[model samples]
Target: MLPKLGTNETMPLQMTVGLTYDLKDDYKDAGLDPETIAELDSPATIDGLEAALRQMGFTVVRIGHIKNLTKRLSNGERWDLVFNICEGLHGVAREAQVPALLEAYQIPCTFSDAAGMALMLDKGLTKLVLQNHDISTAPFAVVRAQADIDGVSLPFPLFAKPLAEGTGKGISPLSRIETHQQLREVCTTLLQKFAQPVLVETYLAGREFTVGLLGTGDRTRVIGIMEIAITDTDGLYGYNNKTDWFDHIQYKLLTLETEPALFKSLCTLSVQAWQALNCRDGGRLDIRCDETGQPCLMEINPLAGLCPGFSDLVVLAEMAGMSYQALIENIVNETLHRYNLPQPRQRHEAA
Candidate 1:
């Protein structure tokens, strides 16, 4: 804890929270790749998150970019903290840029630090870290160009995607390839398109799940485990499908009554990944079962989407008995506690 609130403050202390995210603009007209734009936030995600913070009694400040944030702070503006969700536009460390900026100024912020975010961006690097910790992840390789395809050690039915992308970018039904020709063509396409090394992994054809986590260490808990089922058997939970999830995706809450051992295993794997990554505040861990039904980590979203009405994070949160407001408030409260800052008081009237 850095400092606590006191003195002549009335109506509880107010903390200025700078809400930040990358918005998907009219990129297609700009000739920007729409596939890359899918990772950016929707208007609903930004609006709903902003509304949640204001409802929690914090003074909300809209900070959209690192340059803008710096200019404002230099012009005598101050933000007690930043609510960062910037899934940056370039480089492997793009996700780390804003958090690194805030840290340099000694300003507290939400979500993981720069290193953690950077690690989470690269699928191959994240898997390496997991392997170092003796965690189970599907065997994977990185292909930077056409030459690398011939060296792939993984067998057929391999999954390929951009090494550092989220929101299902570089992932589609075509990502699952069964032959070396398919692999070569897909790898070449992804390399040229995404302009990043492509990660090729053994495809786990079993059940897929995503688990939500909150807080840190002993306080950390699994919020809920939700399985995404694709309505179209030929489709995947890819960018196209995830974007229009209403018509194609179904979210199932894993219950002990129905899943029993699988549910428990999912939760366990999620928490282990959370701890391994040294994740802070809120996060989402995606997993898929191996041929033996053992869980394997797919990806980690430390800056999990908070799209309120939609977003799997919201569904998992609601299942854990936490309202949208509570979810946002919980994030603020946990980050505040980490910084030793005074939290907004919860006052009870009459009753």
Candidate 2:
């Protein structure tokens, strides 16, 4: 049970927090595609996360990749909690390494636990989990190869992409298939090109936004919903869009104008997804509207980005009136609270 804060009492000195992210050095051996590795070392995301934590007065230490991450923790390095940002080394299980290590060490951390990471990383499984819970997700099917696309029952105009990669690795405008033959070709490309299962889902062709949820359980807070305006690009946030293809001339961002009804719905769906996966600390839940403007789950990003200016989560935080410091502080406190760490008495502005 969480401890109730008593008035007129000082919390103790804050516990040390550690940080880990995919390193530039590990890019080659991380088993990711060459192009993918380049983006993994983008520094903007991991460095931004560390900078924010340091500003919160936490003694943040950065470790690179999963190579020896587990061994290092076993060697008596004490951390009250780990801020895990490892997207993974290779395979669908990549995102699960950090949390699994931390959990084995009896140390707490932020973001989704190992199982949640595994489930969410596999988009096909994620959809099934949501469907099993009766949560409305995009209608979808899984194909192991191009030949397996014959019996897909999803509505026309489907989206096909690698079911397990992140950062929009294999997605492109070509991923959108309007006919059965097109769908088969796309699915085959994903399977043969990536050697992974392809996820085919009913495309939601409306607004794109992410719901930022922080903390967990009874105290979880919805930071704010961020709308993605991809006007300069084509219709997809595919590999090219992520790589800044066409310099974003076709991409643009739209304003919700702070629609109250939409905001509430985004919050509700994000929280439901978070709770369904038993996520803790913070994570990002992706939502999209159908042609009729109804919100549905697109996917959940357990390891959301923290790029100083580019990350959607930080962008949402900025809009929600949270400085980077406060955002990091909240994440730290939430993690500490999970393990019942004694609260710190003093509030110091970290340099």
Candidate 3:
């Protein structure tokens, strides 16, 4: 059972939570492409999370965008804390925007801070950080413009993706470039489609996994590792595959009990990346095996998707015997504890 606070719990102030996120409709209004809007949090997610917070004795407020947040907080309005999942509409620093604002206002928020989110979203920079720390990741280079791709040499059978994008954006089977022409075509396409720099890395053709992590530093724990069998994804976990994953793909618990060494190594590397990136509260890491049958880091998501029944992170936790509510509670409780506040017991109303 999760730990609970006692009657003598310190700092017993009634909690109020501010929920912030970009909605799909918000993107529609701005004339963003439907595919791009897929990154935005669904209404059901906001509702489910708000209901959970209310159930836990928190008064909740919905702040949809920076404009509304500015109006409220500028007028001296504030919540005890903010539950932020705002995938900003544009820019490489999109994921960090809300958290940056929260820090400036001195209001605590859930998940990672600005620096952590920024680092995780930038794939090439993230790999560099991991390499500097001696954590194994695929060999990679970045292509900012078409000229940069000229005479480029990393390796054959390379993978290209947007440097800063989530929800499988800018990724497709065509992302795997086996020749110079394919590399030039895909990188140029990604640069146009996402309007961001492209990351070109050595392709890891082995099995892929997404690991859910909770807490921070020594307290961090691997919730579970989810094996993603991209059966119909043309050998790549591309955009369509992720969007229609339930229909076309398979999800499985991946302990690799027979290969205990690989299993243990996956867990260890995930925690290493989490700590190296200074991730707090909770997050997810994408791990893929190298040509040598050893697991290597791909990317980390400090701002992991939270689509209730649909998100892979939630599925991973469920595979490990945790409910969606419990998964959310873990994030909430971890954030509270980080502030040195006692956790409230699971609240139940009178029958």
For all candidates, the clash counts are 2, 16, 0
Candidate scoring better on TM-score of 1 and 2: 1
lDDT of 2 by residue, 1-351 (tens): 123446654443454667777765566654656656644556666677777666666666776667666667667676766787887657788888788888877777788788889888999899888888877788888898666799898888788888888768788788878998898778877798778899888888888777777887877778777776676546666566655534552323223464777777777777877888888887788777887898889888878877665666776777767766666667667777777665443253311
Report the candidate with higher lDDT, 1 versus 3. 3
Off by over 4 Å in 3: 1-13, 256-258, 346-351
The number of the candidate with the highest TM-score is 3
Best by lDDT: 3
Local distance difference test values of all predictions, in order: 0.82, 0.73, 0.84
Off by over 4 Å in 2: 1-14, 28-34, 38-41, 245-257, 345-351
lDDT of 1 by residue, 1-351 (tens): 124456553434666788877777624466667776777788888888898888878888887766677787788776788898887777999999989988888889999999999999888989998989877799999998899999997877899999988878878778999999999999999999889999999998878888888887666778788888878776468887777788988888888789798888777777887888989988898888777887899889988888886788887778766788788888777787788677676431100
Q: How would the candidate models be sorted by TM-score, starting from the highest?
A: 3, 1, 2
Candidate 1's C-alpha runs over 4 A off are 1-12, 26-31, 346-351
What C-alpha lDDT, on a 0 to 100 scale, does residue 135 get in candidate 2? 79
Residue 115 lDDT (model 2) = 83
* Cα RMSD for predicted model 1: 3.1
Error of 1 at 278 (Å): 0.8
Better of 1 and 3 by TM-score: 3
